[model samples]
Target: MAERKAFHVAVVGATGAVGQQMLKTLEDRNFPISKLTVLSSARSAGKAVLFNGQEHIVQEATPDSFEGVDIALFSAGGNVSKELAPEAVKRGAIVVDNTSAFRMDENTPLVVPEVNEGDLHLHNGIIANPNCSTIQMVVALQPIFEKYGLNKVIVSTYQAVSGSGTQAVEELYEQTKAIINEESYEPKILPVKSDKKHYQIAFNAIPQIDKFEANGYTFEEMKMINETKKIMHLPELKVAATCVRLPVATGHSESVYFEVEQDGATVADIKALLKDAPGVVLQDDPDNQIYPMPADCVGKNDVFVGRIRQDLDEVKGFHMWVVSDNLLKGAAWNSVQIAESLIKIGLVK
Candidate 1:
């Protein structure tokens, strides 16, 4: 028997929420790692991170950080990814970026492993992880698209506060506590932190996730729309999205309505198809009041799907609910899965 080779892995933004989850997912999966390097912004450098019960000190990320790294999972921010991802690639490392920096690039593959693992082969040393809300929705939709031939998709996301980052999550908690105690609290982070205005995100839903574009869609919504088309390889596919931030902390849920090209596809058929779908869990027993929800989906890697039914008005339209841990499947786990797929297909050695 031949010995399986372990590679040196580097995690950028090791101190952030998604970065922490990346390390945990790598450990939980027991990924073969000959060495692990945790990198972060200069402010977070020297912070201690524990991986597989061993403490690893985070270093300031620079062009030199990718030296000898085989796989680099990046989640710092778009600007950081823009600057460092190419550097990592230049250093002979394959980067799986969890930011929007490279997703829309014609040369880069926007990948959700279950949907477009094969796209890794065409990668120019970097792979873009789709938006968190897009990841879970597509995971649930891919099987349906494959079986019935999808034509159009409309998704409304109920995303978690954690998707905004740990600061937003903390703001939600602080505001909720203050509100419950009849105290006043100010909103600081949400609906686009850098935007001039911040809105309350506790016990309320913000209809915007990211900055709005000239086309009236938020960046987050546009991400879902564009990334879905790219991953499904359906450039002509019609897709629309409305992204909202809810008080939930970890999981992201989406109400997705899609139209299929094939006629006479029944609800029963969709259920059966998703029952065996890879990286998906079918929980569609509405009789018992079962469905995918954010609270119940925290910390899980698989996308949970439920509430599948045909639209009453349109013969080709069907609606379903999709849920998954935003930090895991949406960011960290997907990045790791991309690395795994690269190894499985011999793209990385």
Candidate 2:
């Protein structure tokens, strides 16, 4: 094992939404850094970003950019990560990729730190960060899965516009103002920008997040389904997701219905379990109107769980609402936490 030292850190796509969050998280978490490199596309190259109160110029990412870098955090895009992540790995950097590029790769570990930090030891240089929606769900589900064993999970997501990237957020803003002004405007860059058609996200809920798959599930929903199984090491576990994009700017919420192998599970039992679970905040009091909301969860790292109840007829079925700041727990913060785990577990040099 290599002796732990302050690392030469690189944040690929340092100018993007998640990239900005990653930089902020690195600072907030006090990650040990001997040097920091910020990389982006040619368009963003030469742009300056501050790290540790010092200005660093963003450079165009290339295979050689990983030289002397101990850990590379990638969130540019799938194509960029697909090309550069292997290069980063070849240069002796452990890549914590925050894209869909290598997520489904059998050799890649799709990890939620709280759920599968132990799996990080098996990395062959690249470790995947799970989808923003998937990360919070797994964190909340881990304790329950460990204690009672999960048989099924069906999640309906109320996702924020930011998940679509910076442009989508701006579009929502403009569209909302347009709707209020009763002005005619065109709809683009929504419900999959490259798809055949676009829909307005102003004061509306879009049921699809990513492009539709041949199996009828949107790519985003499939990511939640498939990534959950991979991270949990439960290929046989039944999982399904209906991902919806709401008009909110931050945080992702899910109404999750699940079945536990353990019978006679009560609402109180689940509450007690989550109350002590790592990275979970329990707020399930219906009478007082207590529950997790996306607006209230913004900037928070903990996954919030509330609205716990047993199914009306099915003894094994239980439901709960889970929420979290997607940018924090979902992307940047989780990626940084994985880096921290690498240090704590002595995986990074």
Candidate 3:
């Protein structure tokens, strides 16, 4: 048998929350790595990160960083991805970007592996990972769509604080502590950090995730709406989203309502389809009070689904709950999964 080849891998934003998870996931999955290069912003450049039980120093990311890299997983902010992803691609590295920078680019493919792994073939040297909320939602919906044909989708996400990054998670912790002790704390992050105002995220639900656009839908919501359509290859599919940030720290949960085109599809049929779906777990025993929740889903790579039921009034509509670790499956694992798909399909050497 020919020896399985290992490739040189580069991880951008090695010090951020999602970046750290990416490294851990690569290690946990035992991804074949001939060489590993960790890159971060100048501020975080000199930090030490441990991968595969070996300490590696992070370097500041630049155009030259991708030299000799076979695959690059990008989790830095969108601006950094915008600046460096092309450079990485120019250097012969296949980039799986975990940012909004390239998702809407017609030349790039927005991928959720279970739903559109085939789209990776059309990539122009880069693949875009969908939003954290969108990733889990699509994983749970794909099987049902394949079995019953989808016409419309409406999703309301209950996202965790960690989706906003480590700083927001810290803010939630500090504010919760202060509030419990009868002390005052100021809000500095949540519901979009760069926006004109910040809101409390501890013990409260913020209806906004990213800044609102002219259409009044937050960028996060628009991402779910548009990305869903693109991944499903349903350009005219009706999709709407309402994204909300909650105090939970790791997982993202969504209440998804979708209308299937085929008539007479029962709740039992959807459950059976999702039960056999790849990268999905079915936990829909409502009699025992079982359902997917953020706290229980932390650190897992699979999307957990539950609470499946048919809409009372709409014969074609069905609802289900979907949850997954935002950092893992949402960002890091998805990026790594893309790379794996690339190797599996012979897109990367």
> In model 2, where do residues sit more than 4 Å from their true spots?
1-4
What's model 2's lDDT at 54?
A: 86
Instruction: Say which prediction, candidate 2 or candidate 3, comes out ahead on TM-score.
Output: 3
Query: Candidate 1's residue-wise lDDT over 170-195, tens digit each?
Result: 99999999999999998989877899
lDDT of 1: 0.93
Compared with the true structure, model 1 gives a TM-score of: 0.99
Clashes of 1: 0
Cα lDDT of model 2 overall?
Answer: 0.93
What are the per-residue Cα lDDT tens digits for candidate 3 across 1-349? Answer: 9899899999999999999999999999889999999999898999999998889999999999999999999988999999999999999999999999999999999998899999999999999999888889889888888888999999988899899899998999999999999999989887788998988888899999888999999999999999888888989999999998998989999999999999989999999999999999999998999998888989899999999999999999999989999999999999999999999999999
Residue 103 error for model 2, in Å?
1.1
